[model samples]
Target: MAQNKNALIRYKTIDKCLQNRYRKWTLENLIEACSEALYEYEGRDVNVSKRSIQLDIQMMRSDKLGYNAPIVVYGKKYYRYDDESYSITNIPLTQNDMDILSETVQMLKQFKDFSLFSELIGIIQRLEDKVYTEKNHRDSIIHLDKNEDLKGLEHLDVLYQAILKKLCLRIHYQSFKAKSPSYITLHPYILKEFNNRWFVVGRKKQKRTNTHLGIGQNFKHSVEP
Candidate 1:
């Protein structure tokens, strides 16, 4: 794992170097950048080998990792991408990847009848739908549920992630009875849907009682701690 991480860091550094059209990139420059990057991440001076970087460039320039980066050398000394806009991180999804995502999402959705998995189905559906839309360049085909007038649906993904990651959130919300919105630090626990409406259940900071709030006009939030 350590070796893999270091190689990943070196590859990123090399890609960054090739992306800078303003600078004349050399092999030594890339090696130095990789060494610096690893040192910053590892908190120690790491010795980046010339051979390793050479192999990394070779690997990036090949189709083995699906990058097939257009690394070119002009003046026989400087290296840059032939296509300046290409990067390994932005590779388009392949057919196999799409198949795997479809299968996995469908499998998970099959268990949504169980209470433990009900609230998260919407989140997973959005993820799959997003991937599909990006891949197909059209609207999502797998429509799960339609609640067009639903409030706070835009914040569902972040709230769900916060609950799963055990993080706190500071949300600004105005209830039906309140005259103005107020901020509260929340430790999100569960998301529940009833009657086509969503509620977030959690405990507020410095409070013992658990509270459930209707998803309202909560447009801004921050982590409590």
Candidate 2:
């Protein structure tokens, strides 16, 4: 079945709720949990009905989606996973899924000649290597950019979430010329990377913002705001 983004989110929420063996999850509780999770992730209130949760549980329990979650009801009301280690995320990709991904990689390889796609070439190669490794049961042959050792790399997810939620952020930043770091309020617009270094492009939250500054000039300041 082709599931919408919201439906997939609800399924994941239900899976997480049922995975918590310490909590006795009822139908009402599951609905409330799913509603809260959707609100937090999507930044909006979404009504999660009893029927929706029931359908999600039914789908997870079936082989239709390959989840086949061992969801069981105890005390005739509370729901829990029969196997504690069972998780929808832990499900491996099927052979058909691998075939589709391999084809996609091949298609993406055709765009490597374009200048716009230069940055993504490394990412595409990494994805191709990952698929090859999973399918062949061996290590990856291609070595791409590994940013695991890069400084301030951990903040990517939080910055991404802030941008998605349309939320302002207080950033503590330091420049090489600056003696110390300063905190500034920023309305994050986009996250960009150039020359293997990550930077956030956004307007500073200030009354007299320096909008006339060029992109290269703006990066020199200790705190724009």
Candidate 3:
């Protein structure tokens, strides 16, 4: 895993260790806890360095990450939170944090149609709601420089949804080369884009028809099916 990603895990691990008031956590104990936590995530042993943990503690104690954790070393040996109720999880989002998360949510919305991002829809929605209240007063952080007049882009989402639902599409399309448009009832398996152009790759609905079709949606249809 990346170092930046691992740092988050270590921070959480250290926070958890300090939260357990029953355990007198030493430096070594904190390091071991972080390593074990990483092992569970990475499925391989991650040697958590003492310096890294020290830096993590320092970062948490600082306002840089918006986590001014009350970490204090007691008895000149063991570590604990100065405040009993303090945990990094309880830290409120700073304005800067909200801005970054707001920008991220907007960026993620553009790719929400992909299967990989399907599970993130709920998370994205929640993040959007969170950042919108703060961001509503200001201009959006991200804006697509897309040409709204692009052909077939409007139908892209409808076809993409059909692909996910395993539903067939009956579309009337007229390619640029042909004088008149043609219609095809297809089982659209995928929608691919190349060179700023979109194509639907699917097979004919008629059985024993070995010919498959790769068509674009630029063609106009006579009827809505």
Candidate 4:
């Protein structure tokens, strides 16, 4: 039963199933309850078998899941886990989930040349393990990019800090079409990139008024600074 792909559940599912069961559970009934709950939670079908349920019962009984899960024979049937509340963290992952996470970790390691992202592979490995083991799949599909290399790194960092602090900046910027450099005071609001080049989006100080600059703003008024 452990080798079957269709019969595995994490520890949290087991805890929720037992909590939802108001009365005692026979082996057959418990298996049914677990399968149904798993289907509702994960939108996946799980086939519950007697042998599989027996092994689950044994694992629960070993105090491995923080429950003194006991087997009781009433009218010649096996029942287990009489406790009211159990933690989901006590659940273990199926071997398949572990293998999939290991493969993903290997892929993340291929980009170790990026210094800022060096530890990201290990972080993801730990996160995958924690999710599968605890059955905490609430925000499971989330991902992030850790790459940090970019041109004008220090200037970009200063712009970001100014935006976060709601401060204005006076910049000396050299424009390709201009004969000389330009000085501009800008209230930083947003930053964007296009064609591998960075751009600043904000309100620029104009000849008698303040004008907002963005992707669609007039090019003549959008001086680089």
Q: How many residue pairs clash in each candidate?
A: 0, 0, 2, 1
Comparing 3 with 4 on lDDT, the higher-scoring candidate is 3
Local accuracy by lDDT, each model: 0.80, 0.69, 0.70, 0.53
Per residue, candidate 4 scores C-alpha lDDT tens digits across 1-83 of 54333334634455555565456656767777778866876687867677877777677667665444544456677453444
- As for lDDT, the candidate ahead, 1 or 4, is 1
User: Best candidate, TM-score-wise?
Assistant: 1
Query: What lDDT is reached at residue 87 by model 4?
Result: 45
> Residue by residue across 42-159, what tens digits does model 1's lDDT show?
9999998889988999999999889999999899989999998988876777878888888888888688678856466566756676566667676443333354445566567677
Residue 83 local lDDT, model 3: 98
**The candidate that achieves the highest lDDT relative to the unseen native structure:** 1
Better TM-score candidate (2, 4): 2
**Estimated TM-score for each candidate:** 0.58, 0.56, 0.50, 0.33
Q: What digit string (tens of lDDT, one per residue) describes model 3 on residues 66-111?
A: 8999999989989999999999876656688898997897898788
Arrange candidates, best lDDT first.
1, 3, 2, 4
Give me the runs in candidate 2 sitting further than 4 Å from their true place: 1-3, 118-126, 136-225
Task: Look at candidate 1 and tell me the lDDT of residue 193.
Answer: 64
- Quote the positional error of residue 167 for candidate 2 in Å: 44
